[model samples]
Structures are given as C-alpha cells and as structure tokens.
Target: MNSVQSLIQPQVLAQIGFAGIVALTLTGALIAVFPRNILYNILGLIVCLTGVAGIFVYLGSPFIALMELLIYVGAICISIIFAIMLSRPLHLSLPKRALPKVGLALGVGAAVFIMLSAIISRTEWQPAAMRSSDWSIATLGAYLLTRYNLVFEVISLVLLVAILGAIIIAGYARRSPS
Candidate 1:
C-alpha cells in the first residue's frame, strides 16, 4: 500500500466527526426544547453548545472553539443555572401545559425546519477569490481587539446587564407574592 493509503483517511474521519456533531446537536435540541423540566433544558443547551464548539474546532478555528467553550459553557450556562436555582424551587413541580399549545408549537417548529432545510439546500456558498491559508490565534486576537472590538464590547455589556437583571428579578420574585 502507498503511504497515503496507509495513513488515516481524512475524509472518513471528517465524516465521522460530522456525524458525531450532528447526533449531539439533535440529541441536545431534543433534551433542551422538548423537556418540561428547566434544569434538563439548560443541561441540554450546554451539551449542544459544546458540540457546536467541537464543530468550530473542526472548521480550523480553535480560538473560536475555546471562546465558545468559555462564553457559552462557562459564562452563559453557569448564569442560567444560577437563574434557575434563584428563581424556582426544585421541590415545586411545574404545571403541565395544554395539549393544544404543545401541538401548535410542534407544528410551528416543523414548518420552520422544513423552510430552513429548503433554503439551505438551494443556497450556493462561494469562497473569496484570494483566500489566505492563514488561520492563526494571533490574527484572531488582533481582529477581536481591532475589527471586532465593538462586538466584543457589546457582548460584555450584554452579559453584565443579564447578570444584573437576573439578580434583580430573582430578588423581586423572592419578595413579591407569585
């Protein structure tokens, strides 16, 4: 066998990785959105986000992958957990939803999925004419502080506001009669 044939096949590995990601994404979505329990949903969201970070890593952007892990898994998920704990008592069971409402939600979600799939199937993605083969952490750091400084600032601001709001709301809920 040739040297190339003896080596691990990139395409096969890529396909397996893609399959794993897709499975994780679907499983997470089901657990997050379908479950009535808020805690399960949050945990599922974390799983989905982690899988997405893995996908980003596969796309040759380890910096983004790390950021994904940090921002989503570290910050957002922890905040959400804190919110859940502060707002709702674990002993209290949530009330069941009406069947009609559940059916309506399912219908809407299915329609959206079909529409999105069709759009994705029809779209033709094109690469830049002069695409550079430079995928570096230094370049990403420079761009984050330079080109995407506003976005970074906005995200930080948003996170700060969310934390403040969560604290206020939870405090109010605790004081007020529900």
Candidate 2:
C-alpha cells in the first residue's frame, strides 16, 4: 500500500486526470465531426460537452462546470436527441458524402486553423484587472435575476417554442405515413 501510494502521487494523478480530460474532449470532438449518423453525432456532442465540463471543474470553476453539464448535456443534447428520434426513422440510409465537398470543408477548416493560430500567437494575453471578489452563487443569481432577467426570460421562451415545435412536427410526422 505504501509503495503504491508513493508511486501514484497527487501531482502525477492530477497530470493523468488532465490528460484524460483532454483526450476525452478530442476523441469526442472527432466522433461528433466524423460520424455520418445523426444519433452518433449527438452522442459525441454530449461526450464532448461532458469533457468540457470536466475541464471546467479541473480549472476550479464548479459552478460553470455544473451549468455546462445542465445546459448543454442535459437540456440541449437531450432535446436534440428527442427531436431526431421523433422526426425520422433511424434506419434510413444516409446519402454518400461528396468528395469535393469534403475537400472543400477540409481546406476551409485548415485555413481557419492557420488564421486563428496566427492571431493567437501575435496577441498579447493579459489578465483582467482584479475587481470585487464577491462572485458567490447567490450574488450571481441576484445579478442575473435583477439585471439579465429579460434575457433569461427570452431564452426560456425560445427554448419553450422550440420544444413545442418539435413536438408538433413529431406528431405530424407520425400521423402522415410517408
């Protein structure tokens, strides 16, 4: 037990955890992007978002991590899955990918990557000026409720409308046999 404990120190464990999180994020992103199946893509997105939440937690922001999980994974991904499942039959064969379009996408992606890399390398990163340290959950909730309540309500309404639309479409799809 002592030997095992010595071999797996806190610093080593932390490094391993960080590496695992990064690997998860990358793998999930690849899965999301490269898969042809919509269901698989959604699952990959969930994995990627979960990995991002893990990274936020690792960076010492548990609130942001929880919000990421709750909003992206729980609400958005689930809603997407529900819509996809109800809208169409999963067994239908997807059309083959066009080579020219794939090539174009790769070229565009590479260009964007190079541009972002150049911009990031040339930019001087600076820490923000330290403000009041009252970043408690209660304080954040109060601020959101008081100042950003309209934005919050608007977003909620949008989501509600989207969900309702999805339900209506699903119902219509079911009734009209293709």
Candidate 3:
C-alpha cells in the first residue's frame, strides 16, 4: 500500500479511539457533577479517572497510568465511598440546584476554556537544548529518588496524613449522633 493510504488507515483509527476516550471522559464528568445521586456521581468519577489514566498511558507514561489507577482508583475512590457511607445514606436525595449559580459557573467555565484555547494556539512551545533520549522507568525512578526526592517524600507524607485524618474523622463522626 502507498504511504498516504497507510497513514490514513492508522490516523482514522487513532482519531476514532481518541474520540471515544473524549466522549467517555466528558460523559463521566457530566454524570459526576450533575447527578443528584451520590453513588452515581462516585461511579462517574471512577469512569472519568479511568479515562484520564488511559490518556496518561497514551502519553507514554505507563508508570503514571499505573500510579493513577493505584492511588486514584484504588485508594481515593474507595476512601470517598467510605466517607459517603459514613456521612449519609444512599437513599437521601441531594438539594435542588441553584439555577443562577449554575449559569454563572457555566459562563465562567466557557470563558476560561476560550481563553486557554487562545493562549495555547498563540504560544510556541520550544524543547530543551539537549533533550534526553532516555524515557525509561529506571530513569524515572532514579529522578524520583534523586532529583525529586523532596517532592516524593512530601507526597508520601501527605497521603499518610490523609489516611490518618480520615480515620479520625470517621471515628469522631461515629461517636456523635447525626
């Protein structure tokens, strides 16, 4: 087959896959934020995060994709669900939306989106003078330990505190009548 035909074949398939992911992400975010059902919102957030993890995979960071699945999908979502269970029954309906604030929020979101798009289109992104040829997991791990050691340690400490705080909060809430 000709180069043009080969390019078109793969490009079309890639575009289709990208569109599917975009749809999944948007749909999940809509369901998460707009739904009155908390359980549905949590499920939608999980779907959205999964789509994001897939995007990370496509961006050539399988490590980040796995970390996203481990931290967000495994830990964060489960913790949120536990907090939801502790705080409120699934049967309870959320309060009605305030139409004025909803309109304001939509307007702000649209403005921000337009501004960001304009800025991105106008900017020229330049690579470093000497780009590294290595994109290996070993290099990433070394960077995490050496160059980014402080950030890595801080994040671990933060996660540890979050878990301890969640446990304390749940304990306190349990002791008090709601």
Against the correct fold, how does model 1 do in TM-score? 0.80
* 1-178 per-residue lDDT for model 2 (tens digits): 8867865898778888888999999899989988788778888999999999999989877899999999999999997887777657762557689999999999999999999999999999897887677758898899889898999899999989987897787655557655
**Best by the TM-score measure:** 3
Local accuracy of candidate 3 as per-residue lDDT tens digits, 1-178: 6866765797776776777777888888898888888889999999998888878877878889899989998999998898788667653867789999999999999999999999999999888999878879999899999999999999999989987897787665557655
The superposed Cα distance between candidate 2 and the true structure at residue 28, in angstroms, equals 0.4
Sorted on TM-score, best first, the list reads 3, 2, 1
Candidate 1 per-residue lDDT, tens place, 12-125, comes to 677778889978977887898877888888889998998999889888887888999999999989987986786568625766889999999999989999999999999997
RMSD of 2: 3.2
**Model 2 scores what on Cα lDDT?**
0.86
Which one is best on lDDT? 2
Lowest summed lDDT over 10 consecutive residues: which window, candidate 2?
86-95
TM-score of 3: 0.84
Off by over 4 Å in 2: 1-7, 164-178
Model 3: which residue pairs collide?
A: none
